[model samples]
Target: MSQNGLRFTLDVDGLTPAATAVARFTLYQNLSTPFLLTVDIASDRSGLTAVSFLEKNATLTLWQGNTPLRYLHGIITGMETGENNHWQMNYSLTISPPLWRCGLRQNFRIFQQQDIRAISTTLLTENGVTDWVPSFYEAHPPREFCVQYGETDLAFLTRLWAEEGIFFFDWFHPTGPDQKLVLCDDVAGVSTLGSLPFNPNTREVSTECISELHYRAQVRPSSVENQDYTFKTPGWPGYFSHHATNLNGQRTQYEIFDYPGRFKDEQHGQDFARYLAEGFRHDAETAACASNSPKLWPGKRFTLTGHPSLTLNREWQVTGSVLKGEQPQAQHGHRGEGTTLSNRLDVIPADRTWRSSPLP
Candidate 1:
């Protein structure tokens, strides 16, 4: 049986059964998906929440698993908030069996300033609580931050205000000690301030910086083997910028570079970091191909070949595969009689995607 389209719904209710207020809900899906989905919800004229307030839209695909499914596009839209001004989101999806399933999972949190009051209250309150208080004076505007987990390590960065709100700053690899710092002002813009050296013994970066807005510190490993680090910042109106580098010092083979919309001040810096990490994972996997590595399996004769066409043209190819000896077992397996072994050969493909392509 072919899977069908997805259906989503959200509900919001007040702490009191009948107490409700104007609440807005927006749902966004990364364009990286085979399809895009977005939903938005708002109040109605009668002040009564109705199902008609829900909006659903999707991007459909004509191709599904070799065969062109008659109707194979995805959708995006939003539903109304609950009666009591609470937020509830629901999504239902349908697609062909085996190839497509409802594999969607979402992580969301009520974002607020890291201030004592906001953190103490919002982080502690439940969905249907009326005891919630918004401390306007004590509220610190939300900053943007991002985190990335590579093969061998993790990195996080955040953009925040500094110097008593006179300057803006960035903190990267914010572990315990070995963190990188950057400061920016209207005159200087953004510039690298310094980096905290990694300490293997303590597994932390020992560094400290005190600015007017906040005090920051970080910790990280001295070195990482196979991993990637990502950096992202909320874009100004009509522009967004994100950068990622493999901990192994490799550049991402394929990526999309474009500006989204401006980010709201209330948006948490950490959320931006998380989004960059997620986007990098998707782009990297799509551009990655298997390669033979001597580091993974030593002392092996392997001829790494690029894409078939590249090999034919003597042009560098991005694809890689191992060459076996007369006896496959002799090349990468145990020598014992009837014993079979396979050695992992490592071969880093020569980057050539940009060699022949036009620069943007």
Candidate 2:
């Protein structure tokens, strides 16, 4: 294996390479967003004729020690190939989850008396997505009517999820390329990873650890005030507001106000108000870290240790990550050449609940 004890194998349409043959790869992952995996490979011939890989299934398996640590499964959505030299051909491929196809088509549709969960499930099912789980704690009252309105399935679904404060992330399987889509509205649904030490001096540590970390905080509104009108109760305009606790610092009193909050009654208005308030404060505080740990993916929690600031040594949840790996040119044909795994992670306090901001 490589110096970082990381290796990977890429299988495209049942055609597994003898070695990973991967020169470089970048995996972009984030909560509420579909992942994109791009990998460059050195092959013996052009993939265009050897294999009809486009739109075919693909999986990238990451290995640590003798065990598989992570699996990225998706469809080969894009590809480019060219001759690198007389001995080998170079190609690159883009892999994305089946859910990504939802954005490829737009339509107009309507539903009556359905909740967000039920509506979203239907959209996912219609797009041929079957492996998904719901982790919601709040009640989703059925709406009288819902409309897709000439938007892509992803666009419509995103709007619905944002309104209900629900988001999703993928969970990689340990043994195969099968990943699960976990839809969550609460932090309890987030998975956790054991603690890792913060060792700034990368050369001094042998085990997987964070080499660099930084804490950040920004000002955001502490409360949300909203009002809506309904024909059934024309005389009474629905009004509701929600506030965050202990955000009494500088500029923290700033308030957000909205008219016609898109709800019919006071109960729904209150819920939307809370969702808006939480959405505003979602990124008020965050942490940025770089690590060699392959387990630090979005929608997962981890604890930090050995930090100069004691307050930084606490539980945090990853909100997004950029994972990069590369192998030296000399080891291209090896079964498992070493891959230098470096990752940049965006995280927030584990105690804070995550909410997707309303899309404009």
The candidate maximizing TM-score is 2
Model 1, span 117-138: residue lDDT tens? 3432332232122222221222
Clashes of 2: 1
lDDT of each: 0.23, 0.81
Model 1 residue 340 CA deviation (Å) reads 4.2
Task: Show the lowest summed lDDT stretch of 10 residues, model 1.
Answer: 151-160
Off by more than 4 A, model 2: 1-5, 18-20, 47-51, 246-248, 330-338
Cα lDDT tens digits for candidate 2, 247-277: 6374656899988787776667888899999
Clashing pairs in 2: 2-338
lDDT at position 278, candidate 1: 32
